[model samples]
Target: MRADVAFVNGAIWTGDPGRPWARSLCVTYGRVAALDDDRECAAAHETVDLGGRTVVPGFNDAHHHLALRGRRLATLDVGHAAAPTRDRLLGLVAHKARELAPDEWVRGGGFDQNRIGGFPTREELDAAGGGRPVLLSHVSEHIAVASTAALRAAGIADLRRPPDIPGGRIVLGADGAATGLLLENAKKWFDATLKPHRIDELVGFLDTASRTALAEGITSITDPGVGGLDGIGMGRADLHGYLTARERGSLGVRVTAMPYITTTHALAGLEPGVDGWGLDLGLRTGFGDEFLRLGAVKVLSDGSLIGRTSALHEPYCAHAPGEEPGRGMLAFDPERLAETLGLLHRSGWQLAVHAIGDRAVDLAVGHVEEAQRRHPRHDARHRIEHCGIASPEAVQRIARAGIVPVPQGRFLWELGDGFLDALGEQRSRSVYRMKSFLDAGVVLPGSSDTPVVDAHPMKGIHAMVNRRTAQGRLIGPQERLTVEQAVRAYTHGSAYAAGEEGIKGRIVPGLLADLAVLDADPFAVDPRDLADIAVVATVVGGRVVHGADALA
Candidate 1:
């Protein structure tokens, strides 16, 4: 039998202990045809020798923000600097302002108000923007600071009360004036008025993002919130882009898209089931030819922790006496969330809710469990995104409900000290509790939540296993996992979250041909040097997508 492609002479980690190593693999029609000794294979249409380099199943980012990532590539990045002061931030904005055409909007992102001390006022933004419309997004993407010109462009001057929109806020000044900060839905009002990018431009950015992912050994990604109208418009176009790229032999990674559920009413026309039910245009969660597929129904339950707006059970540590409860905005009321969950659950759609604070996590978990009791979605594999501050009770409930906790392990490294300062040591100790979740028998799928955190799996693995901050401070040593456990969360555990464990994840026969070759065995490397381990090559669907020379 002739195989479409064959890889030989490599150290392969199948991610399955039973068949943890393989010398060769045959692929046909973009799926693994067989895995065994090269001598046993009859024939192959194409062959590539790895020269004894390491190989493993392609890394899957179980949760990420793809469109936001693309946008950030073109925006002013303030994330990499330290203690960004008012002057430093404006200096960067001013620099970007010079690069833009007059009257064209200047956009930037990844600014953390926590580190910056406070958000910039509209007047300050206007001065730095040089009379042009300027919009800078918070690192969390839940909030944005816009200049007066931008507000004028959006026709939102002297902002009065909006019609009680859920899950959003417009911060007001002492004089009862609207500040430049637009939280959640309010940010959408300004974003909607911004210039739209051509589909080709978006596709190009996506190409760049994909290449970057491959360089990091990422072979698959689950996009948490794809902006679209009933899975049409942007979502449909993105799906087409992936398919077109694959068909034209340009794509090298797999994508699982989750539709954002801002309005449950939109799902009315969409069908249910993995096949033709919720599926459309040859796309289904577990279907397709392994390039793109529909995954989960994503819902934003609360705001961002950095924005100091995530719904918490107690007031923020920084809150003064007699202050309003710092509990963040909820996108939907409990009744509304319950209604949406019931509809989706009854329709057999998988659900993933973004819940950050302990209170938000409790609410989201309650809704999922209640939906299960009312509608009984046994195999949907519901998940809670950003279970960042899970209490012991919440963790137990998550385990009891059999919900997957997709935690952003990198946050511990990225914001550990700040979190420790903000939430107090007691609460901070519970941040990204991988070992606790594992002990409770809950599946803990590690993720990067890119654009918010760096999307390096090694960074996540190191943080998960070490439970240390970037400065080497031990934040939650008791919550650390073993090296093997962390790796499994990135590989098989993520696959299970997306309901693709049977087809992807492991480097075994009958699975999609997605693998990553590394410079050294992660297990053998020093724990402190784990983040330095390099990706020698990355292969997806039988093709060498990156580092062909390294593989040899």
Candidate 2:
């Protein structure tokens, strides 16, 4: 039988356990039809000579922020790469201020106080903003700093008398004035000014983000939050934004968008007396087809680890000068979290809780266990997002619950130094555990949490194998995973996290025709040089989505 496309003369890592390698494959009607010698010289409408390059299943990022990444791409970047010093960050703000109108807002993101020396004060932002409102987001996106003008734009009339916000913090300075720092839910105040007002605007952001994903050979991504109430998502129209993106042919990668759910507050369109909260008309997880499908309901249980806001059992190793010393704060009361988890689980929604600290992980684990016990669903596939500081006991419990731990290996290289500073030498070993999760029989999905760091999967893979920090110090030597295991985490493991392992991930016949051709073999390269390996071509459904000109 003839095929629509044939890929020949390559080292193909199929990612299937039964047939791990193939030299050639044929695709028919957007699905793999033949593999190995069976497809040699098969007649096809189109042929892609891999030119003896190494090909693997396209990368699948289980936890990413496509909307946020796209928005950041359009904004001024004060990140470590763009602005390594405090002066440089302020310079970028000044440059942005000059480019914007006097009344227009100046938006920027991806700044880390640790790397940039210290957080920008309202006074500094005021000077750089030049009468325009300025807003700069932290690398974690859990915290943000606003200029004095921006504070007024958010209705904060008096800096000394900021409004009380639940599940968030408005940090104050020594003089009892707002320090311009907003944490967790407190960032919601600026939603009106920062959030995209139109569905088309959000769709534009998706288009920009998808281009970046395709260039990196990312075929699928599970966005952790959308339509979230805490101002984290693009509001209620976020689902429509994805649909519009797909319809317009702008969304290049398959997406599994999770609705951010909170039981503490009433959702706008929820049916009265319903068992739980979700989209209207009983639309919950698994509602849409491939390319743009609903996955889990995301519930943030705590803040970020690097920001020192994630709820932890023990106090942090160190705190910024003049800052209060504590274990950090939880996003919700324990009882409220339990209630939310139970309601969602009973209503048949897959849960993905953002739990970073050990305390938060244990809290999520207990609640998920109770939820499943009260309403037994063997295939619920609940997840712990981040799980950054899981204890050994927590790891065992995560395995027992069969919960997927979606952690970013890229964090090892980009934020591991900060993690080391916060957790100290002792507890740092458990940070972003990879080998531990695999050894415990738990699936460890790979992710980048893009806009938080670089979204390149090869960088994540390198971090997983090397376990080194930006400063070249090893934080979790024992937690390092092998190169092969890291690849699986990015492919099959991430696919399993979204309940699509049977359809994609592996390049065996009958699966989706998605693959990435690399200029050099990742398995053959030195672990240190793995991040340098670049994708020469990316194929999705037998179509070359990127690097077609480079394809031989």
* Top candidate by lDDT: 2
The true-versus-predicted C-alpha distance at residue 122 of model 2, in Å, is 0.3
Candidate 1: where is the Cα deviation over 4 Å? 41-45, 82-85, 159-164, 229-251, 263-289, 319-325
Task: Quote the positional error of residue 167 for candidate 2 in Å.
Answer: 1.1
lDDT of 1 at 158: 55
The worst-scoring run of ten residues by lDDT in candidate 1 lies at 274-283
As a whole number from 0 to 100, the lDDT of residue 389 in candidate 1 is: 87
Task: For residues 1-552, write the lDDT of model 1, one tens digit per residue.
Answer: 588888888777788988787888888877788888464354888888878877778888899776567668767887746226767888888888989887998888887776767787888888988989999888787889988788777876555543334467667777776677888777765565653456666676577778788888899888887755322123435556556556655555688878667423433344453322233342334555456777777887887776877888886676456766465777678797777777667666788898988888999899888888876656768899988789889999998888998998888887776677667777788777789999998766768988888888888888888877766778878898988788888888898898888898887778888888888788778777778788888888788889987655
Clashes of each: 2, 0
For model 2, where is the 10-residue window of minimal lDDT? Answer: 262-271
Residue 207 C-alpha lDDT in model 1: 71
lDDT of each residue in 1-552, candidate 2, tens digit only: 688889998999999888899899999988899897454346787888899999999999999999989999988988998999999999999998998889898899999887877799999999999978999999999999999999998889999999898888899999999999998878765664566447878888999999999999999999988885455787777888898899899999999999888422334534456645555666778888768898998888888888888989998876668755589788888997788778778777899999999999999999999998898997899999999899889999989999999999999899988898888989998899889999999877899999899999999999999999999999889998899999999999999999999889989988899999899999999999999999898999999999999885
Candidates in order, TM-scores: namely 0.91, 0.97
Reference-based lDDT, residue 99, model 1: 90
